[model samples]
Target: MKGVSLAPGDYIHFKSQVPLHKIPIGTKQWRYYDFGPKVVSPLICLPGIAGTADIYYKQIMSLSMKGYRVISVDIPQVWNHQEWIQSFEKFLDVINVHHIHLYGTSLGGFLAQLFAQHRPRRVKSLILSNAFLETRSFAAAMPWAPIVGWSPSFLLKRYVLTGIRDGPHEPFIADSVDFVVSQVETLSRDDLASRLTLTVDTATVEPLLLSDSFITIMDTNNYSAIPQQLKDQLSERYPGARRAYLKTGGDFPFLSRPDEVNLHLQLHLRQVGVEARPDLVQSIPKGGTGGSPSKESDKKKDPDDQPKDNGGNPESTSEESQLPPSSEIHSLDDQLLSDARICSMGHEDAIILMQSQYTVVNRILQSACELFIFSLLPIYVESSYVTSNNVWKFRQLM
Candidate 1:
């Protein structure tokens, strides 16, 4: 019943739109997805134990397109909280992003608070999702934390996956869960073990200098892997913090309920005084912010805009539905043809062009890539074209 849209299509769109970058700060290798204009202060997202940087592809796609700088990062295999703080500091320094708005989920939330507590100036604001204030209860439950690193991958995955509740979920929620399971499957033994170790490690987030007004506690109302008591304690800790509660976003609101989550994020960004890049603010296609496309992109509504119907609904294709109407596919084929011409002209070897993988590749090609993804990929999303695995095989075409 559920249509998986993010993979090979939207997901590959994300990959093409915002290329992944790995920055090695000494022993710690950080894998992250960064997008949007470089001028604005970036909103950095940290995922929980069962997730990876790719988990926030929705955030990257939705917000970055609208002019916000969003960076989604994976939790490296750091053993402890103190090391995490240090490694994270070095990561920021390497990237040269002086100030950031930290958005963390579960363990990532706890880590965000922990980092803000230690390095107050670097963090402009904090958004904690399904986060806890302390690890005492977690440590108590995981009595075998000391031996976590030695645990086998299956055992570690079992332990980490226990946090996500199992049930007959709605199609979207089921798709979200399926996506998460796929991400968890990508984790290395050390990655899973270290994340579990951090969850159980005895650490508490102390009070911070940042105002509660600058913090947004975004949590799901339904159910969370983190206990309700912890969520309550966190709310109590920062009584002045803004509350952005979702009506029904299970553990991963940013995944299962993206529009709501993105809405909250944009509001929080505004509250925190972070401005969208002015140059990009109006150029957003489809849902335009008063900016018109240039001469080249004349007919194209922002190339990144999802393929939508005349009713303004995202054109969705369930397993039960037929291929999208020919007009739409024809539109996509034309843009992809344009994209091919652009890529070929930009680089002598088209293969090298795709391989170069610059984040921006400048505005002209950025729009071209966006056109390439939205034009070609949505057809794949709206109809079952191929699995995400096949997307990697797309490289073999070159």
Candidate 2:
């Protein structure tokens, strides 16, 4: 149970690939996961009240693999906003990162903005999701904010967990909530107390000197822990800020909707002049083309295994003439056909296509020619694990 993951094996894999770094700057302990290349500018991820550095594992895994530097850090123990900001600044100094792109959620978002406002030159861009412009409502709700430091750990956890809605949720959202609960279980009495104190500290972010173009306000269209009015107010405040809106990702979109969130983050980084060093990405050998898959599906057939076409027009099956099935498609063969237009049903189902002795993963509905767009798409997977993190991958039929 200790090594179990709510969302498959992401946690285990994350720990294996990225080492945890705990550096003490004065009395504050800086815990974080710094991944990807060190040369490029870093993107610092800060989480909300119930979050830790590990909460942004999805971001670290995806971006870091693509040669982007991502530092997902825990907010150092601090009583007030100034201390938090100063401690973060010193932590960055200790890390030797001169400038950064900040990504924050909830209370972390406020701290990101505050830091940006105070140290304008040090922050290149900001991406705030489900964050607040002010904590007035929270302070008002918890009249005993001053006593939070003295509150029991269980009480503090309850206060934090109550904010995360409990009940039936979509599969991904439910998994995300479960994962956050697991993270909360790891927090110490001081951790929860410090975050709760920040939440109810009644501080507001001042007008930032950074341009709106360098800011991206990401949030779900569906309900979240943050108030509607607060989100609206933040939007209104930054009229020129890039608005990356998702359909329904709840409170923790980074965990629930990592694909969309990572996509937005990449776009933000590109817009802010932080380029990804794709050359630094390492190649892992997977079965099929040049190697063997870790676990070959019983129904899978490699190009070498298939009979050669006489005319070389690529053999068209009967299923290729029609749209693929609408039900739950488990295998790649059952999911794909010769005609890409027919194979792509646009239901957001994963499809695998084997061609030219290589495997291609087709994730999104994409275009009529799935393989053609594979190179054009930024998040496209060239070749990946046949089964990664206990999740099936997508490959476009070339």
User: Which one wins on lDDT?
Assistant: 1
Candidate 1 lDDT by residue in tens digits, 179-296: 8887888899999989888988888888999999999999888888888999999999999999998889888888788778887898899988987653553432332211111233
TM-scores of all candidate predictions against the true structure: 0.70, 0.70
lDDT of 1 at 258: 77
Clashing pairs in 1: 285-302
Off by over 4 Å in 2: 1-7, 283-398
Positional deviation of residue 52's Cα in model 2 after best superposition, in angstroms:
0.7
Question: What is the clash count of model 2?
Answer: 10
* lDDT for each residue of candidate 2 in 107-224, tens digit (9 for 90 to 100): 8998899999889989989999998889889989897888999999999988899999888899879878888888888899999999888888887888889999999999999889
Summed backbone clashes in each candidate are 1, 10
Tell me the spans in candidate 1 whose CA falls farther than 4 Å from its real position.
Answer: 1-8, 281-398
